[model samples]
Target: MEQQSLWEATANERKERQALQGEQHCDVVVIGGGFSGLSTAYHLQRKNCQTIILEKESVGFGASGRNGGEVLTGYIGSMELHAKKKGLEAARQMWQLSLDSIDLIEHIINTHQISCAFRRNGDFHAAYKPSHLDGMKREQEVMERDFDYKKIKVVEKQDLHSELNTPFYHGGRVDESSAHFHPLNYALGLAEAVEEMGGTIYEQSEALSYRKESGKVVVNTNKGRVIAKELVIVTNAYSGDFQKTIKKTIVPVESIMIATEPLSEELCQDLIKHDRAVSDTKNLLYYFRLTADHRLAFGGSGRSSSKRDQENLFNNLRAGMITVFPQLKNAQVDYRWGGKVGFTQEMLPYMGQLEDGSYYAFGFAGHGAAMSSMAGKLIAKNILHEGGGDNPLEKARLRPIPFHSQHAKAVGMMKFYMKFRDRIS
Candidate 1:
């Protein structure tokens, strides 16, 4: 059987193949051409820096292309928790950084004129009971009073009738600034712009090994190898399988998604009066949104098994969607699939240089859409400093989860337990 790929699901779009078959060298060689790799290449080319992007498959073939396409506006870290860990000052900076990710993403999209099925409406945090609403209200109050989360507003159950098609939840919080788009298209758009800016991207160029020797990193690939003064490994979950160090940092978690056939304008409006995206307040998150063509695109984290193909390409998430919006019982599904998302033992991302002049970026967790993109830009900025500063890639100061060793089983257990709670909660 033909192994399935995320890129294969998109419209008949195939990136050009590399015809050259000789060894090559560059100033910087980026392995893994997903969002992080593409974004890093984009920024590097814009800075007039010499760089190349190597992908095991096509551009955006990883989670970047296959994500549920949510443009969330905040970090995965809870504000209250951050305040405790780093105090109010550092927590504020962390919160603001997340908001800035929104602006930076839009700026890139606009400057490049990428047709990515983009939108600007926000996402929602829906609740299933009054107690859930009350807890959300408290969270909202605290966030507004301390962090200026003014975009979040309380939604009552009565007001939900016209907004959502599901009858499951009582109320929720609506954030009017979060957006959703075609993730694959956006990733591709970035890839094209990066190449146009004079960056080299090699598809089917798989990195097999790398090593730091004599003050330079020699990277081995399937076709040929490139020795670079600086090396970046952005493979995320799909690391070369050659680097034990990188592999130990992130454990892959698969997320399932389903797409419904385009509905009539009237039917679409029945669910999203403002065309917003939604996510329920559960550990095993359920997220859904309206496509530009009036279809329902939904996804949720956590899976039934470890084998990527064993759980099946996609299981029916519609029953859960129905619980949220009962009006879609007969909705026609056009696609059903899932892809792997990597997370560290801690939910936070792991970025910055491991000692010895090599850069490592991975574990954006579930919020890779913005975090990965921002991380790449930060990596480029750090590379720019001819003199590495005291705070190279300031974002890296956040220490990685101490229990990186427990990431694999911990994440799987977390998902399994969370799903159990979600079904009952």
Candidate 2:
């Protein structure tokens, strides 16, 4: 019951990689060392490209390491809504891409021989209110008719007890294509694969600035400068001011999680009979799943952002756990952690080159485990001129959020809206 991530605690010790030293050069320089960056570097290395990855901290130190590890299919927003707005054919392609993203994860795990306890146990989208079932029904129908997808099945309130031993949910949908895994281990495995393929990764080396000079992209870091013919930015929610324009196009929201001490096997079986990852239908959602060692990893968002207020945040999360399963009221909490997720106005991820010709991909909302990996591969394909097809996100215009300087205030307002919506709906 350590005060750290269960994945980090159990993962194998990572060997240190050297940081960038004065004035190095490569064919491509990637900024950030999370899933997106590591995946991109791995694929690029496979194509015989000389690539180098720069990380502000160790690999996977950002959301990639801290996530709940639910590798789910599809984007954050409603597929039905996307179909209506962007046409059925377009929506179907996007849906297929999401499924392909899941396939990509399995391929990486199998190909790289990664031992991250990858499991395709499926995912449950529980309805917080009865009205939410109607949308699930519509989504299922759309997936079947328009996309020819049939892995998802609607679970009635009566049948939900068999899938999950919870009285809080009215009904839900289960998709068998989704999965859970040790996210940190997966990222580390990719880092190892990248190095094995002759690519270099520099930890603790933050990219400070980048400029085009003499037909090359010169990126300055705290340790050294990297000159390359191409550059890729995969910072996601940790973008900070590194790329000012891209940062403005996304909103970083804090997502907090807490893990309980290992429950008895019988209790774990009773809590989630099918061992599926679960997420409720609320603007401020709660997602949970059982870890490999049988710990209940529960997480959600809260209003406060202060680190000093963690005790209150932990209490709030514990109350949420009890609300979902009162049997866990006496369970001892083990770990408490939080990370930021980037959300776009459309609630979908964006990928493409910037006005300066540098490639970039981000804004996956909270459904990034699969999407981020797919995005990295796609970005590399685009860079190599391998014809990865036209990415819809690339067509999206990067629009800055209004009053971007008041992000904290905006998040406060969003919390209020979510609470009101949860109450009325």
TM-score of each: 0.89, 0.95
- lDDT tens digits, residues 1-425, model 1? 11243334654355675822467767788888888898888888888888887788888888888877888866554566657767877677667767677777888999988877778888777786677787778767878988877888888888776567667778788877777777888888888888888888888878788888787788777668877778887888776476666676667776777778879999888887778877776666788888877888877764554565434435446777776667888887777777778766555667777665667678766678867787788778778774254322244433433444545455664665465444333
The deviation in Å at residue 400 for candidate 2 is 1.3
- Per-model C-alpha lDDT, please? 0.73, 0.86
Q: Which lDDT value does model 2 have at 246?
A: 84
Q: List RMSD in Å for every model shown.
A: 3.6, 2.4
Clashes of 2: 0
Query: How many steric overlaps does candidate 1 have?
Result: 4
- Candidate 1 has an lDDT of 0.73
Error of 2 at 157 (Å): 0.9
Return the lDDT, model 2, position 62. Answer: 88
